[model samples]
Structures are given as structure tokens and as C-alpha cells.
Target chain A: MHELAVTREIVDVAAEKAEGARVRRVVIEIGRLTPVAPDCVRFYFEICAAGTAVEGAELEIREIAGNARCRACEASLELAGPVEGCGCGSFDLEILAGRELRLMELEVY
Target chain B: MCDHCGCSTEGHEHVHEHTHEHPHEHETSRTVRIEQDILARNNRQAEWNRGWLASRRLVALNLVGSPGSGKTTVLERTLKELDGQMNAAVIEGDQATDRDAARIRATGRPVVQIATGTGCHLDARMVKGALEKLDPQPDGLVFVENVGNLVCPALFDLGEQAKVLIASVTEGEDKPAKYPHMFAAVQVVLLNKIDLLPHVSFEMDAFLGFLRQVNPRVRVIAVSGATGAGMLEWYECIRASIH
Candidate 1:
């Protein structure tokens, strides 16, 4: 899965930042609809971090819900899963969130 | 002898043993929190590719859909129709083989194929390298046909001017609802194989309704590569977007 590739990048970034420092934790922000599995990323992170500065680092993932704004009704709604329109029967909608995959912060000493 | 604990000859021994390997093994585990975008590196490459394309005034379109959605067929037809009028190049991305690239080349257009081996989608870095190999000039059209997949390709942007989603009538109207992200990310929705509409049970109204629901502003064009039905409209849309 693409999670492997994503995990590799996370490890690279974390290892680069944690040079000469001991990594305590890694917090990642993942959107619900990003098509990336948290468990898969976590699983790959352990392998990717082997012998690196991030070895034995804890992976903390934050799942973000998908949010959208209806253009016709002007209503903002948060969706738990995939659905096209807003609750107001409006086809016009703009995605506000739940498409993110980012590393928010890291704790190292 | 230690004055603190009164252990007989143990303080020096303990201190010396601390630096050496012990007979008993202890397991140590630590936790670390790393918050970062998994696609950060890919996104950076995508941005750079976008800048490179923009500098050349090249309009790159990434065509994405499931296999047999007639993506290559649409391109073949488009190239044949736009012959001599537009300078078009194709970078065909498939899991294996250069068959699509060959098909595009048959139209006499410069084409390159990027076989992704086992990858389900084409990343931006692959596109960046393909662009260099193709060396398209400004005002030329660059069409990137992504690997035949509906899910993964929607997550990665290949530095294209627009992402076009191709869906045939045979795929059913529920495809838009089922794969919302792919439809939502696309600026143009090409409803291919309209010739089979009479044979298939595709509901035009429902399909359009669902497509609009997912992407309200996405322009929809119905065409059939087999029969050449409604192809002029599709060509005009491409022409308008490119120049």
C-alpha cells in the first residue's frame, strides 16, 4: 500500500530531525478519507526506523474527519464516511478537511 | 567496601560492570510521536513539477480511471482529430508494458511510457522525469495517462493543469458515488461509451445527478470512442482548456 511509502518518508524526516537526539514520540495527522491505513503506517514505521534515530519511536496518529461546506445551503457539515452531497440536499459542496496527511509534531530528547 | 551501602567490594565492581555486557538481558521499549504528512515529499515534487510545467506554458492533463474506461481510446481519438492543430505529447503510465505508449505513438505524437512495475498509481516524481525525457515545448499539450486505478490515483497529483476522470456507461451510474474522491478531484468528467447506452442500463439523469453531487462544478461530456458520438464536444473542451 501507499502507506509504506508514506511511512518511509515519515521515518526519513523524523530521523533527519532527530539526529544526535533520542526520539520519544511521533505524532501524525491523518485524514479519514486519505486512503492510508494507520496500522499499516505504524507497522512500516517500525521497520523503516530500524537502526535509525527513530528506532523504537512511538507513533501517535490523529484521525481527522472530513468536513465540507454546502454552496447552496451554506451549511458546514462533518462527514464520518464518503457521501457526495451536504445534508441540505445541495449538490454544490467544497471539501474543507479529511484529505490531509501531515506530520504535525515530534518529541525528541 | 562502600561507605554508602556497606556492600563488600561491590561499588567498584558495580561501576565497572555497568560499562560491560551483563549476563542477564533486559528489554527496553520507547515511544516517540512523529506528526508529519506522509506524502510531504511527493507533494513537494508535485509542486516543483507544476512550476516546471507552468514555466513552459504547458497544460498537462492527468487522465485517471479504472481499466477499460477508454482513456487511451479517448486519447487516440483525440490525437487523430487534433492532428496538426495541436502539439500533443503523451506520458503513458501503466504497471507494466509500453503498449499504451506505442498506441499513442501510432498517432505520430511524441510519447513516453512509464511502467510502474507493481505500483498502483503514478507519483509526481515519475511525471517529472517523464517530462524531461519528452521535452515538450511551451503551448504543447501533455497528457499523462495514469495507471488504471480509481482509488490510489486520486490521492496523488502529477502536476497537471487538470485531472480528468473517465467513466464509461458500462461502469454503472453508482461509480461516481462509489469513487467520490476521484470524481471530485477531476475538473472534467468524460462519460465514455455512449454507444453502449442503448444496450446497458445506465441512467443518464442519475449519473449526472451523482456526478454533480460529488463535484458540482465539474464539466461533464458524454462521448463514445467506438462510434465517435459527442467527440467534438470533448475535443472542444480540451481545446478550450489548453489554449
Candidate 2:
């Protein structure tokens, strides 16, 4: 799964930031439309974090809802997944949010 | 020594020592604000690759598709037709085996095979490694046939100018809706195995409709790698991109 590769990256980033300190928690923000499964990330994070500074660290994930604005109609639409078109029958929709996958913060001892 | 407990004599303070290991009970913890993109490393490598390609004036296309979508077949045919006309090389990515690389070598072209082992898709770093080994010339076409996966490959950027999707008629018309990310990411769609249209239960109109619903700007070309049908259009499309 792509989540496995992504989790390795998460562990790497966290471990580097920890910098010899034992990590207590890792907070990540994933958008609803990012196509990354949170459960899979959690599963892989444990495996990827083993023996690293992030080992046994709590993984906290926050999902952000998809928000888009129609370029043609200028209407804001909240989406759960990829949509065919905006409600205003326009294919020109600019995504405002909900494609984010970021490591927000980390708690370390 | 006696202080609170007062168990010792005057001028002495009594202290209690812990026998159990309480590692973090008194440890001070702090939160570090990172606020960094998770794919930042991969994106940085991709940007590096983009610069490398732009500097050499090379156009690389990332061909993504399912396991049996005939990507290698289409690629073999494309390389043969472009022989002596346009210089080209290939970067074949698979979970294992150099079989595809052998096939490309048979076409008398420079090819590099990247066996990802347990990796599901090819990342930009892997492509960078392949680029160094392949060393395709300027004004040439480099086709990167990604691991035959519609899902994971769509999420990775290999610094290609455009992503081309190879989907056959047998994969069902609802492919676009089923895998929207892949459908939305590609610039061109090569609907291969058009010769099998009569035998398969694929609806061309419905497929096109579903494809349009997901990606309104994507160009779809129906071609059969087996019969060499509609290959001219595909070649023209490639020529348009390079020129």
C-alpha cells in the first residue's frame, strides 16, 4: 500500500525532529480527499517507527474535510471525495482544501 | 535526616527513594511545531528531476495502467514505429523480474529495468536513479512504464511531463469512476485492445462518458497494440508533445 511508503516518511520526519529525544506523540493532519487511508497509516507507522526515536509514540491523525470553490459559479462546495462537477454544473472547480497530508506537531521527552 | 517525616534525629532530613523505574513521570516534554508536508521529500526529488529533464530538453511520459493493460505491448510498438525517426529510451518498473527490460532490449533500444522488490510504485528518487543509468539524450522521449498499478502509481510523481493511462476494453467502462484519482491524474488515455471490443462487453460510449465525468480535459485514444490500429493518432499525440 502507498500508506506503507508514506508512513516510512512520517517516521523519518518524526525521528529527525526528535533529534535524540524520545518521541511521545506525533500529530498529523490528513485531508479527506488525500486518498490516504488513516487506518493503514496507523498500522504502518507502528512498523516503521520501530527502533527509531518515534517508537511507541502515539500517532494522532486529524482529517480535514474537502472544500472547493467553483470557478464558473463561485459557489463553495464541501465534498467527501472526487466529484464529477460542481453543483452549478461547472467542471471548473478549484480545490480550496482537503488535499493536505502534513505532519503538524510532535511531542518529545 | 528529619524534615517532613521527622524519622531521623535533629539536623537530619528523611528522604524516600523509588525502587521502581518510573521513566517519564518527572520528565519534561515539549511539542515541536513541524507543519511540514508529508511528501515533501519526494516532491523535492521530483522537482530536481523536473529541472534535470528541462535542462536537457527531454520529454518523459509516465505510463500508468493495470497489470494486464498491455502497457508494455503498446510501448514496444511505439518504440518500433519511432525507430530512427525519434530517439527514445524506456524505464520499466515492476515488483520483480527484468522480463520487460529484456523485451525492450529486443527492440534494439536502450532500456533500464527497476525492480522495486516490495515497493508498489516507483517514486521520484527511483526514477532519478534510473535516469542516471539510462542517460537519455536531449530532444528524446523517455517512457517510464510505472508498476502496473492504477492506485499507488497515481499518487507518486516521477517528474514526467505528462501521465498517460493505458486501459484496455476488457477492464470495464466504470474504470474512471472506480479509480478516480488515476483517471483525474492522467493527461491522455490509451484505450488499448480495441480489436477485442467485439468480443468484450465494454461499452465505448459509456466508457467515454464516465471518463469525461471524471476528467473533462483528458484526451482518450482508442488503439489496439495487437493490430496496430489507431497507432498513428497515438504517435501524433506524442509528436505534438515533443515538438
Candidate 3:
């Protein structure tokens, strides 16, 4: 849904970077907590970039793991998703990372 | 070199000095490291909204929930409570129709509606337009009732001071764990339709226990749109958050 907006951004950014050079590939990094589907983004990207500089450019997705902090002890630790408590029995937690959605690089000719 | 055309020209057009890449140079492809945030445009718009709201002393609160979670009902009631004490405005988002906006209009408050059409969630750009149309008073509250959906809405930021997620007892007890993205993003959670507790098989204690586990700092408010049982508490919580 909102991926339409994000996919538009990817095309815009990638095309701008391409600068008539002809895009070959575009690589992106998605975070676990960002809640965006890679397949959906690719589908929209093709539609939004038709006949443009990024048309048919291969898209590669990489993952970024999330990290969290304990609200009680302030200890930062790796997080897979949502959890009930920290190691010390504190239910309070703060997620610090894995929210990233960035266009990392591009292969242009 | 100009990236746009791979040509950065300096002199007058036609009569230019001979310039070319070496014949032996082979440039098949190049990898440019962009490392730019894909949502930078949205982030900028959201930041602008935040600045605009802050300069005007407007407290923007985003309400997120499932379609049948009674978000509109809760808002209709909350606007009533803030009628005189705190001036309020509403920016309602729905897939189609101005019905929500029409409902809020009856409260005699400034209200704007965004019809997303086929879109599932409200983005910052839509919020920007709604804010311009809303023109919330300097010490007022702006309620952004997001298009009802727990998942996609969580990914988009609308420059609200905080996100308030509503879940109904009819939604059962495992919603928090099932939709962790929405539940984790908010600082407050409203368990709507508490009046239905008598008839529903919802396990309130277990739900509360799981919610706390998912977000220990999250404030949970039990509300009933039909009975208006905990509307006051909701208003108080809003006051506590903004002030």
C-alpha cells in the first residue's frame, strides 16, 4: 500500500543517480522492523519506472537485524521481533535499530 | 563529467576542445554507492509537519486501529469532551468517502478528510495537506485518525506527537503479539468495547499481561464507546501526554 510511495522514491533516487548512464542493478537494505515487503516494492518499482532510466534494473535486497534496549537496565541487545521481557525480567524494552530502508548502491553502465 | 548525460561541458557549444576517454580505458559498468534513505522525502515532509505543529503549539495525536475497532466512535466521544477546554481539529483518513469527516463536523470542530482511494494507509504528504486545510488553533489538539489497519499504517509517520493504538475486545487477546509492529510502535493502547466483556470470551488478564510484555511502558486504557465508561481516562491520558 504505502510501498507505492516508497517504490516511487527508489525509482526517483535511482534514476537521478543513473543520470542517463543506464542502470543495471540497484541494491537495497531492508530492516526487520521496517515492515516493507521486498516483492511488493519490486513489483511497484517496475510499474513506476517504465521506459525510465531504471527500467528492468535488477533489485537485490539485503537484511538488517534489529537491536533493542532494556527499559529497566538500558542494556542494548539484538532483537528478532517483539519479546515479553529482558533477561532480568523487565518487560520494558526499546527498539534501537533495524528500522532502516535505504537504497544502498547501484550498478550503472 | 555530468552524470545526467555523462558529459560535463564547460566552453561554448559547438567549438569545443578535443576531450575524450582514453581508447585503452574500458568502463563496462560502475557501482555507485547511494546509501540514501529511500523514505527521505517522506521523512522530510513529516519533519516539516512536526515543525509546523510545534510552532503553532498544536498537539497532533495519531489514532491507529483495525477497521472495526471503534476508532471513530472513540474520537467522536473524545472531541465532545475537549469541546470547550481544548480546541480540537480532525484529519480523518479512509479508503473512500467523507463520512468520517462528516461525523466529526457535527462536533463543531475544524475537520478535514483524506480519501486514500486504493491506498491502505495515510502518508506524511496527505497529512501535510490536511494540516493546511485544518489550520488548527495554537493551543489546540489535532487528531489524525489513520485509515484502519494495524500493519501498513505503522510504517508511515505523519508527524504526530505520539501514536495511540486501539484494539477491541472482540479482536481477541493475541492481537498485540500477532501485530507486533503496530503494538510496538505506540506508547499507548486502548482496549475498546470494554462493555462487551460480559458477553465476549476475551481474556482481559492475559491480554494485559501480554501487552505489558510486548511494551512494558505502554499505557493501556479500557474504553467503551457505547457506555462511555473510560472516556474521561482517555482524555486525561491525552492531557498528560501533551502537557
Report the error of model 3 at residue B102, Å: 1.0
Tell me what TM-score chain B of candidate 2 gets against the true chain B.
0.88
Order candidates by DockQ, high to low. 2, 3, 1
Best by DockQ: 2
Q: lDDT per residue, candidate 3, A1-109, as tens digits?
A: 7788788889899999888898889999988767787789878878987988998889888988888888789887786665546788886767778888999999999
As for lDDT, the candidate ahead, 1 or 3, is 3
For residues B107-222, write the lDDT of model 1, one tens digit per residue. Answer: 99999999999888899999999999999867878999999988878878788889998899999998988887788788998899999988999999999988877788899899
The digit string of per-residue lDDT tens for model 3 on B165-193 reads 98999999988888877888898898999
Q: Count the backbone clashes (under 3 Å) in each candidate.
A: 20, 5, 0
As for candidate 2, its clashing pairs are B1-B12, B1-B13, B1-B14, B2-B12, B2-B13
Per-model TM-score, in order, reads 0.86, 0.91, 0.87
User: In candidate 2, which residue ranges exceed 4 Å CA deviation?
Assistant: B1-25
Taking the candidates in order, what DockQ does each have?
Answer: 0.43, 0.62, 0.55
Candidate 2 positional error at A18, Å: 1.6
Q: Estimate every model's Cα lDDT from 0 to 1.
A: 0.85, 0.92, 0.87
Model 1 chain A is weakest, by summed lDDT over 10 consecutive residues, at A79-88
